[model samples]
Target: MKKIFTILLLSGSLLVSGCSDWLDVLPKDKQSTDMYWESSEDVEAILAQGYSRLRTCVPYIINWGELRGSSVIVPGRGTKTGLIQNFQVLPSTSTVQWGTFYQVIGMANAVLKYAPTVMDKDASYYESRMNSHLTEAYFLRGLSYLYLVRNFREVPLITEPYVDDAMPNDVAKSSETEILELIRSDVHAALATNAAKETFDGTWATKGRATKWALYALMAETCLWAEDYEECVTYADYLINATAAMRPVFMSTPGQWFNMFYPGNSNESIFEIQYDETNYAQGSGSPSKVFPYGTDVTIDSYMYSEPMTLRLIDEYTQHRGDEISRTYYGSFAGTAYANYPDNGIIWKYSGMGVADREAVRTILDANYIIYRMADVMLMKAEALIRIGGSANWTEALAIINQIRERSELNPRSEVSADNINEATEEMLLEMLLDERDMEFAAEGKRWYDLLRYGKQQNFKYKARFKAIIMENNLTAENKWLSSVLDNDNAWYLPIPAEDIFNNSLLTQNPYYE
Candidate 1:
């Protein structure tokens, strides 16, 4: 399960280093009128920390994708063992104890509140740069809350961001419907907040940041979850029309594609987490390190190898029958990269490949990207298909083909109702998944895709996953999480018990019962 990310409601007023006052509405400790955010640097640092939280943000999506996807199910506690197995019935509150939402929410709230106050008093502080900085807080705060509403179905909508001792004894848990509505409201307000309206388009101080379009792109996604097809199309279209510079396309090789994730590579990204390996200890710690290639250590370190499947390597070509020589590489013998072995052993964990063991590492510079242009068009296409049906297939196919051509492939000439009918959603979804796979190959999309497709818990997943690992020489152990109950409880991750005892109004998820 994706760990729930909630900030602890501190009993005392916390003078924390990382988060800001925008989120912590009322720290239990009394504040000094003497201390207030005054400079752009102060505003920037506070917002930077808020932004950094997105990297380490542990929301429901991670769990939703990892545990509840279509192909896998909670085995009978046979092979894998843990709560992830019995997910469907797990209590939502179990995650509340250690969830990331509260912390983010707290920070976001603090930023939104204090940034305005900080920048408000002096007109000089309201510089164009500071305006955008203020807007960043809104974008982040709204984003943090959206993740909250999606995963748990309900949570305390804390605008003040912090939980003071005086906070109501009975904090209300908004229902999904209510929570979603609240999310939309916040999103709408974020869209309207006047930030760097004219200067945001330029990116020197503002590189790798959010604009009104970023919020719109996200709004489109949120609308899709609500099944508001029209709204989805509208918001996505707005983002696409607005951010014309961020055109996205897939690069052919893993090296080319993976390198794009290096920090500040503004190829297609509209918003991303800026990680300098040396400076930031935030986010999920570079997903690449945690993924298949990551060396395995049992709370320790040792080299472990995970290979990509022949099926995947095979899929890379797009065309089924390529020459045998070009199909494989690296350690696999008798293939292009080599020429001697039985099905090739894996080698993503190239820790042994590290040079100068004692050398200090600077920035690995990889970012977890959230929005890009290609997805905007595709999202638009999806909405078109839903709202306009086959009549709009031409537009959808056009978008898909534009992407294909970018990768040096041919575009389709026809996109008819019949063609739309013949090709299934599964096929289209595969296209989306494959695009995500290619662009974010090693960066980590496998788990999330599975969740959106509702395939993570399908029992059929294990064999499917095993087939890939065997061919790739990958290790399936760490990649897959085990569960406790055979039932859906495994699907619903355990809420850290801390939240249960504190929040009286919050009910336990059915699985917990």
Candidate 2:
């Protein structure tokens, strides 16, 4: 089932075949939405298509989520990524489009729209299976909106299926708050159906499909974004106490932690997009070629994109005083670069072998882990601290220490049940932020962490990002990039010209306009 869906999903993701109203086509294979809604198998195929289309956005997700505020530098001057890294993104950058994500939303909406008709057509056949598929659809729609709201801020919220008679192209943007509410409602519907991870067939399906575990992780994440810290802690606590089978245990050993990316679908993964080399002919958009790690000096030729900043590498290895820890530095390497002697390579999701004797080869079947145990653990710690009070702070410290211990970093001492008494809330938050950068570097998370932290600290994140860009510049051409960063709304990329010209209802992000 995993291999079959992986193959079909990649192909279907391209055509998203049956979505007639959205594409304004006859759908060459005659899989038109109206005609295709006649069977449960048809519904399953559409759901599979949704998953396939999602894989298309893996690179965009990483690029948009991490590149903007990250400590990465794209060595070449004219590259699209270099423009993004320098905060000089224009409406024309090819990376500005959001069509792929909306395609996923359209397919998911089709499942939600037609699944009931599927149940009505063959009640006996659908009785046990309908809810599981419906739950998956709801979770996916909610997940799509979560991505949109985080990146785009306010996006059009479309729930109905875009059938032949009802295609609306001029829909206006919904408020971010409104989108969050709809997301919460969709997640609740998914939970009400109560689908278990084991119910999904295939080794990859168990972790790939939307389970109660994934739903709760989404809830905790959404609540954290909404600033409902109490609710965030509640959901995080549920995940922490969840059974091992439902919620995979966090892999603590260094070897397991590093291997988690290559032979993915690990016990630590909550939900990850499945990518198999044989099925995905379009290629996996493997980061290995970009964030490459090897004994070969040839690494310098193709791996210049997003080389980790010396500051980030320094943070990862630096322990107490000026002493550097070899354990933490094990995940990074100094790849030879003609321009710089100390260029750092991120091995986190490089798809390289973790074992000492395993041959280091570039891998294409690198799966993207969207949510994992370590991420939630750190989130739980942040939530507990955000809820305030002395007890919460102490508990939060212990949680952070747990993650640090797993990473083999020095753990904090629990001083008189207060941890660091001199530590203000800002100091505690900074500790958690630094730990996140160390643990999740090159995993497309650091930029968002900086945004969230910046929001918490009076927009200070903007100033920090500007400083990094200015300090790292080698030429005066990109110096003008710092001036654009002065506006608070500059944090979000402008709506692409393609989207704006196509729909008059859509407005460019104000700062960009």
Candidate 3:
């Protein structure tokens, strides 16, 4: 059973229970924090609430990762999403708030605080179980903070729950380096425990919970962000070399990849936000709500959003012709576009065999993906290229070839050692980046992949983004896009003005000011 993200029954408890006052006033309507952690089940319920908070953050995560990516072509020029994609958001704009993430972090902190207390109170509450709970808590907090740092760049480091004014409320933002260090500490603590135990309470915790395997994947991803390629290789190797049972397998073929989305939580999934149609009231929040489908979309007629751009659609078209793209990007009447290239949309997250827009309800239970094996394998390839020099070129090419072969295509002729050795570092990096773009299309990995490249002393994403958008008539003259390309600070989002207003000591991101 997928135990990680089972429909949470404890949200009501979260609202009514435990220190509603946040200080000394214990809950009157529900269990107090002291009473809540009395059992592992209770701890599970609280952690479920934290997961519940994460569900709310899914769309925000997409926005931060994909909107400004300039991949999607939005027809609604004045729309909020369009503005964000063009990098025109203002500090006063009520977008991309970090408040919800802090809520998740806060609940995670509560877990860390009380799980140990339960162990002290009951002899049956074994140390291993307590450590497991603590490990999950740290994973949740670390993951949340990583998202925050990625989007906002700098945010207050709140490790403890807010109890009273005696604790600082108006904390200033910390450097990305400092935030990353804290993330490292949390994941490291999680690794220190027996979380790799893989199963808990007889449920497949590997799929649902933060198994040691999942934490290792997260650590590798985190290390990549920190530009610690060696550490990335270390953790990637740990996961790659895990027992055959633990190792994430590439789906049988490129065709099976589409199945990963239709019926998610596949063997390849390292970690994903679980959704149950029978249990989850609002399945996957119907990504259609965010990406948008035409009002009258039906199975017979095409229904896609404008923001999903012709560029992305063309890329999808190319994939269809070459390898394993047909299942992913289908045409309504053998024509790819519902309305030509302008209204093209990625149908992966839309639903399964959706007969109509309303049929989306039938397949709403989508697992918000985090890491998968194919993506990780390519990541390791990039790490090898970055750390091991020319000797590693052949190995990296072999890894990339594995993904290509999975798609039923022969390896690129140019990826051989001689070609790789002769290619400039920029050329090799660009090749890797483009490969990621194709493999991870619509997975929300593209923008971050670009940003990761840009973060390395020299800026390449600016040129790449500019070149891509220049092809799109919609963004050809976009002034906001021009500003973002010219200025480094514009890359990170502005702290919502409301955030700055509420926290007097908090400063705005320098670019916004």
- Once fitted onto the true fold, the runs of candidate 2 whose alpha carbons sit more than 4 angstroms away are 1-30, 196-199, 279-282, 289-330, 334-343, 412-419, 456-482
Reference-based lDDT, residue 190, model 1: 64
lDDT of 2 by residue, 448-472 (tens): 7766765643564556656654554
Candidate with maximal lDDT: 2
RMSD (CA, angstroms), candidate 3 = 6.2
Q: Predict model 2's lDDT versus the native.
A: 0.65
Backbone clashes in candidate 1 total 61
Per-candidate clash tally: 61, 0, 2
lDDT score for residue 510 of model 3:
84
lDDT of 1 at 130: 60
State the TM-score for model 3.
0.84
Question: Stretches of candidate 1 above 4 Å error?
Answer: 1-34, 37-42, 58-98, 127-134, 194-207, 243-259, 279-284, 292-311, 319-363, 408-418, 421-494
Per-model C-alpha lDDT, please?
0.46, 0.65, 0.64
